[model samples]
Target: MTESILVVEDEVRIARLLQIELECEGYRVSIAGSGHQGLELYQEQQPDLLLLDVMLPGFSGIELLRRIRAGDADTPVLLLTAKSSVEDKVSGLDLGANDYITKPFQIEELLARVRAALRLASGRKKVETDSWLRADDLELNEATREVMRAGRTIELTPREFDLLVFLLKNKRQVLNREQIMTAVWGYDYYGDTNVVDVYIRYVRKKLTQDNQEELIHTVRGIGYVLKDSL
Candidate 1:
């Protein structure tokens, strides 16, 4: 099946160019000029990936991302923003954007990111013999995309959920930031590694919401490991 992409860019010329190029690449494309319409189309289409802009009329892309991640945690969202600061990018990534490209981006770069995001999303959805991933009392239902600890549910953003899944799959293996970022985020992150730390904290906070033990252990000066006991 041809993968679908929703382009939520207010810029008409850019949107047209992206749609033309993306369609040429054989993807089913949908365009929304405002954040409101973007969200509406997003619900209606449920595209495989989103090419969303940060600036949009009414609600911003960040707000749109927040709303989508509130319910759907698997769709790949690649933000299209003009903001180039690390802070700006981190803000989007924190909101669960799979990746981002600043405006004036090369078509090649943008296409590459689109492919990577879709590929990562596809890889995560592959069926496995085991439906549940667990560590002690903490468990994740891949089929349901639910996380639970000691029978209590934990709500996680898309990024946090992916991070936790990676950690759980690696169990006792110590995974460095580089390895974690590559496996979870698809492409190697060019920004600060703090993004990994930020996500780890998010997952840890949720997993231990009721004073549960932190199954993810930090190895000072190295990285982190998920284990029943450190």
Candidate 2:
């Protein structure tokens, strides 16, 4: 699944910068300009991660954090605060923020922390859901990250595994490249490369190894669809 992030920032330029950066990293990003809108988006979207600014127009980030933590203590929230004082950090942390970064910090550092937070969230999610996703003879174990097709174990790279999971979850549906890229790769390709096609070929090659039947079919001028014909 694609990780969604809601960024609550009153600064237009900063919000746009964050949307672009996070989307490029394959995360679905939403921007909210005030605490009210942030709260609305938070309840509606339930994003996987949140990047909240400490200062806002309607309500303070601290108050927003408090409101969110009242109902949700699980979603990872990282505060973007200009204050470097320990008290300020502690305040947000007390309100249940996973971490905070002082403003005017490097984007690289923020991105790294975002990755860490999402990983932590993903880990927690593993034990809560059924471990297996299946279609016909193919099976994917979410916990073990294992894939097996027609009694043959197939090893896949991490990205390939994510793509396969997305495909399996939406089996029998015709999925376009943009949707596939956003869901699997977590970003829009913008014609930057034929990554979707390349990865499809990679997966097909492995799935059809040893004369196994092909499960992924092309829709010609459209996109690809996964439907087991067995």
Candidate 3:
């Protein structure tokens, strides 16, 4: 089936250009000239991908992205913004936009980003996940974010759960602090790397509540790795 793309831009010329180009590429295109309409159509249509402009008549693109993520976590959204500030890009990525392109972008670049976002959404792996993570008698259901060691339930914050998943997903591979920060916290961050260490400590403390075998292994001079064998 042909991919569907929703173009949400207040500028008539830009919207039409995008629609025409995307259609030429054999995609089904939908246009929404205002943010409100775009969001309304999104909830109803649930297109494969969105080419969303930052400035809109009623609602801004940032607001639309937040609303979309709040409702649906899997939909891939590529933001089109006029601002080139690092802050703007970081905010968009942090809010769950799959990617961003500044205004006055090349048609080829725009098309490439569109294709990449669509591919990511389509090719995402749906893990046959159980209710929780289990290592021996310890368990943590991913669905409920409940952690239990030796039949005793352990509560964890959202960030701690995210950290645990990241480590688990990359089991046996040493991931640097920068990589953890980028993957878990989103990009455009230049702050201290201590945050990654802090979250790792939090997860470790929770996992070791019952003095269970440690699944997270520290590399001393390198980084963190998650594995049962190590």
- The count of residue-pair clashes in candidate 1 stands at 0
Q: 3-103 in candidate 1: lDDT tens per residue? A: 99999999999999999999999999999999999999999989999998998998999899999999998899998877556665788899899998987
Model 1 residue 92 lDDT score: 85
Clash numbers, per candidate: 0, 1, 4
Tens-place lDDT per residue, model 3, 141-187, is 67657777677777888888888777766767999988899988889
Q: Write the per-residue lDDT of candidate 2 for residues 41-87, one digit (tens) a residue.
A: 99999999999998899998889999999998889999999855677
Q: Comparing candidate 2 with candidate 3, which one achieves the higher lDDT? A: 2
Report clash pairs, candidate 1.
none
- All models: lDDT? 0.89, 0.90, 0.82
Locate the minimum summed-lDDT window of 10 residues in model 3: 125-134
Backbone clashes in model 2, listed as residue pairs: 26-186
Model 2 stretches with alpha carbons more than 4 Å out: 130-230
lDDT agreement of model 1 with the native: 0.89
Query: Which parts of model 3 are misplaced by more than 4 Å?
Result: 83-85, 125-230
Best by TM-score: 1
Superposed Cα deviation of residue 136, candidate 1 (Å): 26
Worst 10 residues of 2 by lDDT: 185-194
Ranking by lDDT: 2, 1, 3
